[model samples]
Target: MNFCLPYSATRRVLAAALACAVTLPVAAAFAAQAPAPATLRLDYLHTGNASTEQYAIERVVIEPLPWPGNMARTVDDTDRGVNKVEVVDKASGKLLYSRGFSTVFNEWRSTAEAEKVNRGFEESVRFPKPDHAVTVRILKRDENNAFTLAWSTELDPDAPDVVRKQEPSALRPIPIRVSGPSPDKVDLLILGDGYTAGEMKKFEATARRMADQLFSVSPFRERAGDFNVWALAAPTPESGVSRPSTGVHHASRLGTRYDIFGSERYVLATDNRALRELAQNAPYEFIEIIVNNDTYGGGGIFGQFSTAAANSDWAKYLFIHEFGHHFAGLADEYYTSPAVYQPSGARVEPWEPNATALRDPANVKWKKFVAAGTALPTPWPKAEFEAYSRDIQQQRVALRKAQRPESEMSALFKRELAHEEELFSRAPNRHAVGAFEGANYEATGYYRPQLQCMMFDRSEQFCTVCQDAISTIIDLYSRPAPH
Candidate 1:
């Protein structure tokens, strides 16, 4: 049986270094004289649609925890995400920090509803509280896939109106793996929802099990010590989250539920404020919400959060696959599923690491990893795979229409995966790392790094290019300051 440590449980890993120390030699002196900077978070509303968009400032707050990221690595050079946030010094206009991220709003804009009605989503971005005032600029990609300023605001962390006090923390975080200070590691927080007070043990157990599963996978497996895993969840009144498709509705701790955007398997929390309020209590750079239901559903947003049904049969696969999106800005490589997004007629380059528009075959984004003689437009058994997938999808729709048991859905997925593995195993260039067509919810034009990957399917490992991409982010967070 799994159990959560009580609030009295002492933290197992203490901070080995301070947040302000940019290098090793200065760490001791800095630690002795300077206090770690507080965390400043900017809350705003993103309202828009497919063609037009607007942003509005909601508020600013100082979180309970100090900044969790490395001071030396303040700028994100990894060309990823649909949007980027840049914080600059107000006086000299020097860029202080920046990171790329995707939003629920961006995903919603791709769907059919965006053509008619406008929607709004609350968002927040955090940085180390600066000593002086700073200007925050949010950049969005234009039609040509270049970033342009969407919104900009001047922020004063010491302003009288900035929210500095928070409700007393009702829940404490459990340290699953604490390698070192949060500033020196990728601080990942696993939040549990739909877990009742009596099932707190289950949440803790699942969190620990998932952490082990994550570390057992490649890249993560090889660099386990570069991470610090923390678990936090508040007790819910029910044992499972809301599933409106089945006429079920139970309020969960983090407002997480299935059937996002009317897709049965899509799970995510729409309440960013609720999520951030609880997450701010813990030191976290990434979040993966573990829903306590036994449903086959999950969702992820780049640099924001990921979700997985913790008790699902395919929990391990869902855990790692969704994390790929949240952790490394990896695009989904599979295209067979009926996603909510509408198809695009024009080919625009995606900013994700794995998937590409392949508009210029000669100058592929991942050309460095491509081997000689490997075709730019790599061929695969597309017709057969799609045919098989269509049939399976039909059966899947039928099963769901009948309101079948979760076990039935799980079994069907197993058979589907088995079929795919069998087909790919016999194909030519099955293991090649060339661009394979059919990705990012499209059947053509877009490409993936390899024939098989966790992003592509329910495989247990990331592709070589994916491994490198993940390593780059890990380096951004975990690499120590210059000697």
Candidate 2:
């Protein structure tokens, strides 16, 4: 874990510790001057039905890479996720390390299937290894929107049961962008799935292209220097991932595929263990999975991972839009699209930084950005928008029902975006930060920050509120907290 050793000594020690021939570009002045602790991961099982949930310890792992986070900013104050993990000193109950993240299990709980079935999901939380035992607590928001303790367990990084060593990975991380030491930069790993050895070059090129696409946006473009991007992939036996809806299935390294939760375009890797195992080889705080397919599909979960179809015509938009969810827990601002989650009868304020229930219009969550005279429930072309969206939705369903070409779907999306842009442009509050009524998959209660955003539609940039939310996380990983 010590990075203060001489260049030669550090190289030898790091090489020995990794159990692999691959070397990171960390033997430099910053590393030689600082000390970074080893990374510790707590793998656990999150299981339950719609009404009940439980957590159990699976195993602890000491990852080969050091902790890729700002040592001074170990506590997450953003409060952006449905769940939060806190590492506390067992003896003194002092908080050590904490982070906010969402799990697939929580997402599944909202599905109608969860009412009749109980399921389990593998989940993991990583932190800098502490010197002593710590009580890891998982907190979930109650009806009142406060984090209440859900589960707790004691763990010692030095315990004999801890996994201290791992078999070397056949895959090596390719440096797409090297800003600085990982501790001082947001380490983003671009992982590829469903890519064969013959398509390795294609995967790397796609990864680079996606990384470039991500940084072309507002917040990322302005703060490009505060990030380090790495690419890694375990070559699959064949190309393209499983898409059950279309009856296309292929073996993939990460087990990521399309048609998750019965949504045809929704893609996700339910294998958390596989994802963490491959990702542990690289220095990463956030992950963006790029599946080798031309289908327009991708998905994201807060503080966990995002995915995009690397060869899709809307690849750039998917790469950044899904990252909005995975990177900063930005909620989907659009409501017309069909989603897997069942409609909630209650109107509780969402934990996402973007969307809200708007119970108190005078004091909306993003109130500061609201103009002096702007209306609370900012009026837009709602009726027209919804009508247009319904027609487009029908067309979308027909395209999928008939198994139409992807190009046709892409063309439909282009038209939809064009119609939306023209409609919103004529609205009075198109650029206002007032609450636009319609977000989080609900057309009634939830509201968004602006008339349009990446989370809302196929837009190129995030709204002002979303950009601010993203900047908060960027600062959390890239620099020390203000004293």
Candidate 3:
């Protein structure tokens, strides 16, 4: 008894106490923490003309609390938390097929920033019926472990009535070509502007026609099986109202009054406050901006947007041409005319598939096609070619002046001197000569290899250059083979 317990016993007792001291608190901490869970429910509402889908959900997002406010903030902020949620069809449950989206709190308030985010989010969600209805609700997880709904709104999928004014013909699917990368399906989104409103039937017809024309094109024709078209019908004319004859002659420093180029900036979705909202609903690799006006003029910017005058007979051509610009980055081969914006003299290389400065001639992208004898700054054939050259120059001036109706001018040129037929012939001085009538940029001076091409002029076919560009674009956006 006088002898203390052995030193080993004393050391063992201290070690056990220390281990318990560290282990117990960790166990207690884990016991105190809890995992968060979230769930959402969807209900489909089919309104006669339009359908609506509603999503209801309550979610809890736990973030690490900082400093003194951590525990207290978690308790107070529990009421403020929002659930992030999305709803998809039961059959196609992929996120890409989600029809409804909802987010809690104003994470981004800036208009431009919000627009960008909204666009991205919209692109990510694809409703089974884009023209169906949708509704979203955000709720807080209450202390009782129940969803206390805070906000809710139903989205209307305004489906237009397929009113058959006449006997319903067989619904013929429009044929389209596919040459680029192989996609599971072609995602086509057609945006309706003022032109689509009054002429719903015509708009649909034109859309179908365009789809057919697209199928006729190469590469797209090859991949016709993998395409779908979605039209976002807005209440607008397919072509703008014809400007009064008096207004036609009014010229501005910018250009002719008939040059209603800037009208595109004003076109917006009527139902949806923002274009991104509609774009988000149906994400498209190609967006066809159909205007209501008929007086022909359209634009395309690669990887950006393609616009068309809905009413022109050549509307189909404009659609494809601008699409080439928006989708393929093809350049305007005809160059003698002026542009809305002049190059800043900065050493810039165009991003289009056709046309080049030969800045690095040896490594030019289309170098393989340049003939062996073709010289840089290709020589302008001499004065003997002056007649053709003069014709081209005169037409270019007329085009810039917006002096005559395009149809009348084209018809006049076609009848005179057989310019239309000879435009693309491969004579010794063919590519080297004066103006060629059908060239896209110039009325008569520059000659394209083909008499008719989507780029050079409407009422013609797409040339080899345009075809190649279309093929390249199709390839770029297509999904690659899996590794």
Candidate 4:
């Protein structure tokens, strides 16, 4: 919603470009007949260091579009993320809505920078509009991996401080794929960044291509008809997003950029306010931003959004790999790549469905998928794999250091993937669903469900365990609420 903020120039330009906002035809259909509740958003500032955190309400917004999620699946039963948000009736204490999500702030806290200084991040949680007052609570996992209340605040949707209306957005969403009404299907908003007005057609085409690639993968392939994809972009003057590591910079609309936390390949959009403003114009439950660049970079946060380099040689892999993190909170299974997160002193079982600590191998979370006599700590060509991985990492660093052509980097990765595939093919447990050491950024102590997975490398298909995790989320959005 529009507020008298300090950015008057931005507001003026946006208002001029977006004269009127229109809702999607499918959204309109639900509104005219079996209307869902109005969407309510609670915006806040999450601040802290690695040890301590604080949250303060910034504002409450009534988004223009109705709730795009299924009314029956309001509570998130899949405990995947680092944090959880719960909205409850203030009077009766009945839980009205809940969803598990992770934020850029959470990831930042894990970086070495958090040990030295404090930081703050803007975050928002949306749910069906409530009729009365409600209590909002944020929960974080404790040492035992159980959720404990971290922050709580009372909210009144009808309060005078709430913002209800805004200047219409000039941008409208292009329907890439409309299988059914939004209430009966997953609504995915494909937002584009670093594309100029002249490249609008290119942006739409890229979005369509990526959406098609996503469905071509398993789980999504089987549930293609259960999704509705929409594409939207507010053009920028430039053709590529910021890459500060290479001395490149551009004032993109969504702040999508590379070199986050000093990791050259880590891409993310840090402007929550701008992102929400543009996204509010569409009906969506999920978002994936495709930056108009060929660099190999992208990032994803659960229940937030994902991004990819639309023109990269591995755009299809980047799209689905990052979506696994954003969609199902799947943990990265590979540990060879350079990352920004600080290593933990102890190994606690990860909340992600794909990775585990294997402290109690007998009761492993995915034990159902394990064969009768599969070893608890599945063995692979660990020594050979790690040795080759080290050499590849050195070459990767040298390529970046010398500023080699992206083609060279792509070719190097291709060779590396081929070597891995060949090595794994000879392993005895190649097709087994056993815990393989090396996952969640650690080579030891942590384990993954399978040796080869899209989350692990530049592979095409998700591992068996990952496919099941994804299907659970798909069913949550497409099926009617469990009665």
Candidate 5:
């Protein structure tokens, strides 16, 4: 296994090394003029109930790695999230960095609990290190979906209170797929949760397998070369994550578990500190935590992280479907599945690319993609589909209440998809790109693009609109935006 490099390659490397050595003084002079940019993270607390919200600065830190994003594409104009972060020069008022991202707290606020009690969440936003002091502003969309400043804070990188150093960690990331330099590629960190020391190999294998499945789908398949996949995991003492409903508990490294917000199928990592500490050890812009569990559960937050049950029967679907939310801010297109989030009386047009309010069908958000003859609020066996889905939902509830085997749940999903396939295959607008009612966990009001999609069901392939949305994010992370 001790293979040496080819003679010519070795000579070229040595020559390059010698060249660096000879230009040390010149290099040092240039470095002094313009040092490489570090990654600066602003950690904060987002606290409030459903109606009122507040933001408080916690601390600022220099992440372990340099920012792994294209400096050329610092401004995010895609307008996708419920909130947007803007970093600007304080004195000159020059916008330097900006990005739109949603939060777990935003999702929580939609739930019934937010009506009575207030809660806080630890959140962080990262940007390229600025040379001098800068102003960081958090903007939220008003009722009309316009960005309005919610909170603003001044930050000085040289401030003595800023955390400039971190203790070295034993956690190292394994390179799953290195396409090119970190700056040019979208760094996707596949984090493993609830894995023991003995399951390290399994974690890597699952990460690779899921990564392969990711690239097998459209958009990601075509843009596979634009991504670099990195796998990282801190070992746990137990074999699986906690399932509070099932009375199963394990001290996982990432604090990932099911039963989030009282939904047994929902999974998320609550320990943002532990997650950030481990994730900083690797170069990553997006993260997908692959939890070692078979039960059907996953969750995603835009600009944050996503989790998938790596051992589930529908792992591929879970990974990509949840990623659709975490990566591109795609709304949940399926409504048959019950959710904890309560619906608002108002259905303002969603900022997400996939979901729309269809306030005006002729001026639909994705109207350009709509084909001729395709009706707005397109018709698609709605009554029949809802009736069938309701029956299947009751079966689903029975299975879960009976504490049925995981295989039984998987089998039920397979049956449901099969039924949907048969039902939609004959519909006139089955494959059309038009507004389809019944999305965003509501039977009406909200509409999704196309009749069927991975977001809409367990089926494969993102709808045309979803594919475009995902591509926009990939470009935002990996390439410069159009001038």
Candidate 6:
């Protein structure tokens, strides 16, 4: 007290002590915070009909967030926006949770453009944690009103069974094969097309019937419990029962065109924006386009969109068969059918599972299925083959005569059901010659593997080759439900 320090020294000592105390607390706080959990990434690949749109997810992973008691799972749809996701507990076989989200972009014509849009969308998604076992689905939109599911998850990380990415060249290309709700639980979304509010109910019924037929088949029957069907309804004004047309025309490939629907040319070629917008709401494995018309026309390109001419007598069968092509990469077996191909390339090995020019028979995709006694270059019966060919020539002549612009003959052909029926009946052996009236290829040189199949004709039966292909696709999607 007698020798007290100066005021400046006293102030300096107090300041140093205060600084030390502050630093210690700050260090403790930093130590208490934990680092973010690692992320689990998932990618989606789609395989459907060729006539429909197709897409794939390139970059994105689903990571789990740490949460107790399986109450809720957090998902990070990395970089790509999360359109929709559904969570199902495999053990419980019950839907635990589901959510639908939206995005700014509507559609992209090219995959590159889609990826860019997805990248921007992905930046906006934030997750609370990164370590959880839950299934997530992602979709991207495109033209033809098509959307592709890019990813999914297996709910229990501890379970040995899980979904895997398929090789690009794998023979079967579809994501899921079962027809009913899955035991392991699944989330499905049915992409929509030109249908109105009234048509939506019919569309759903049609889809349900198609799904039921699909599971009733062999491989699907085996694995019926591990699947689900969800509809993502996308409707348009052009998606109704009928439309104005300039009468049906006969082409050597895709026989008879009814140019009445304004949607035909534009729907398949343009409409990507609408597709993407619809995809932003649900988790789906496949995107099915339900056209509003009831005409007997449908098209499917492998790993692409599957479409059915709506409201027809054969809608259910047509749906399943076309879906086989879109989902399973199955090849058309009837080669003599009318088609859109120009036939320019050298007679090389075809990419389809059923057709081949025998460019290299030794390594055919379906070589295993070829019967031992089956002859290579199977001989066509001369009498029946010639009769069918003659009928085609006559039909061509009739079609040309009726095609005169603005003539009564054209009008007569357009309204004459009897004439059309008579013409179709002439080619009773068309199936035998493998020359169907409405396929996409020339009649003589090409031959489809099966004599009677839905792909070959509107016949209800699917050939063994097609059935096998469907089975393989189902296996790829999930393990078949127990018998």
Best by TM-score: 2
Across 1-483, the per-residue lDDT of candidate 2 in tens digits comes to: 323322232534553444334554533212532557788999999999999998999999998777778888999999889999999999998999889999899999999899999999999999999999999999998998799999999898889999998997777788888887677888999999999889999999999999898888998998998888989999899888999888898887778999888999899987899999999878899999999998999999998999999999999999999999999999999899999999879999988989999989999998989989998888899999999999999999999999999999999999999999999889999898998899999999899999989999998989999999999999999863232
By lDDT, is 3 or 4 better?
A: 4
lDDT of 1 at 227: 87
For each candidate, the alpha-carbon lDDT, in order, equals: 0.85, 0.88, 0.40, 0.89, 0.87, 0.42
Q: Model 5, range 1-483, lDDT digits (tens) per residue?
A: 112232222323322332233222111111211224778999999999999999999999997555667778899989989999999999899999999999889999989999999999999999999989999999999989999999999999999999987776766677788776566668899999999999999999999999999999988998998888889999999988999999999998788999999999999999887888888877788999999999999999999999999999999999999999999999999998899998788998899899988999998988889988888889999999999999999999999999989999999899989999999999999889999999989899999999998999999999999999999999988853232
- Model 2 pairs in collision: none
Q: Estimate the Cα RMSD of every predicted model relative to the unseen true structure.
A: 5.3, 2.9, 23.3, 5.6, 5.6, 19.4
Q: For residues 195-292, what per-residue lDDT tens digits would candidate 6 score against the true structure?
A: 55566666677667666776676545555665656554544444443323434322111111232122232123123323433432332344556565
TM-score for model 5? 0.92
Residue-by-residue lDDT tens digits, candidate 3, 1-483: 011222122323322332232222111221222221111112222111111113322221111110111111111111111222233223443321211122211112212233333321111112222223444443433334344554454533332332112232221212123322112334566765554346767767767777787778765677565555656554432234334342523211111123332232122122211343334333244567676655556666443356676666567767777777666656565443344332334333433345444456556545555566555434433333345646765775565367566575445445533553454353453333122232333333333332345565343456665576665544444432232
User: What is the alpha-carbon lDDT of model 3 when measured against the actual structure?
Assistant: 0.40
TM-score of each: 0.92, 0.95, 0.49, 0.94, 0.92, 0.50
> For candidate 6, what is the TM-score?
0.50
**Model 5 whole-model lDDT (C-alpha atoms):** 0.87
Which residue ranges in model 4 land beyond 4 Å of their true spot? 1-20, 23-33, 480-483
Clashing residue pairs found in predicted model 5: none
The C-alpha stretches of model 2 lying farther than 4 A from their native spots are 1-20, 24-30, 480-483
lDDT computed for candidate 2: 0.88
